[model samples]
Target: MFLHLGGSTVISLKGVIGIFDYSLTKTNHVNNYFNNGKKIIKICEDDEFKSFIITNKEIYLSPIAANTLKKRINSQNFTEKVNILQEHPTFK
Candidate 1:
């Protein structure tokens, strides 16, 4: 499953697992809207921005990539990273 978190970035939940065990359990108890599976691709950390691009189905930023994306997000530069991803083609 994919989600659009307002910006141009995207998140893919397929086969992905939650970082915290409690979150996983809590999420599983909720009424799933997508019914895609037991996975969460979208997350928001304190003091950080979160966004997604549903069309591409990829997670753009997390705490791991926050440092790199901070300046870009501040400048509203989204497509540059997407373009870089397309050009390099790393993970699925």
Candidate 2:
């Protein structure tokens, strides 16, 4: 599944190692990660910034809030479950 990180940015859920709160994740810490060749992609919505970090060698700064992204993840998980059930013979 692919998660929309706001704007044109979307990432594969399989590669998402972590989803973190930007307030707790310091800028300097992210910069340090960047220096190590970890790619950083920022998705901005207007001027507001509520970034979520996705690290799987690369770090993505999503414009969406952590809580909101969590909700989306949960929703996707639920959808995946439903799809799986539907594909099963017992479900029919």
Note the Cα lDDT for every prediction shown.
Answer: 0.31, 0.62
TM-score of each: 0.21, 0.67
lDDT of 1 by residue, 1-92 (tens): 34233335344433222212112222432224224442334445533533222222322333333233334443553332332121111221
**TM-score of candidate 2 versus the correct structure, residues matched by position:** 0.67
Per-residue lDDT value at 21 in model 1: 17
lDDT by residue (tens digit), candidate 2, 1-92: 87788888777777776676565444565455557877667677535567656557677766777768777878777344211110223212
In model 2, residue pairs whose N, Cα or C atoms come closer than 3 Å (at least 3 residues apart or on different chains), thus clashing, are none
Candidate topping lDDT: 2
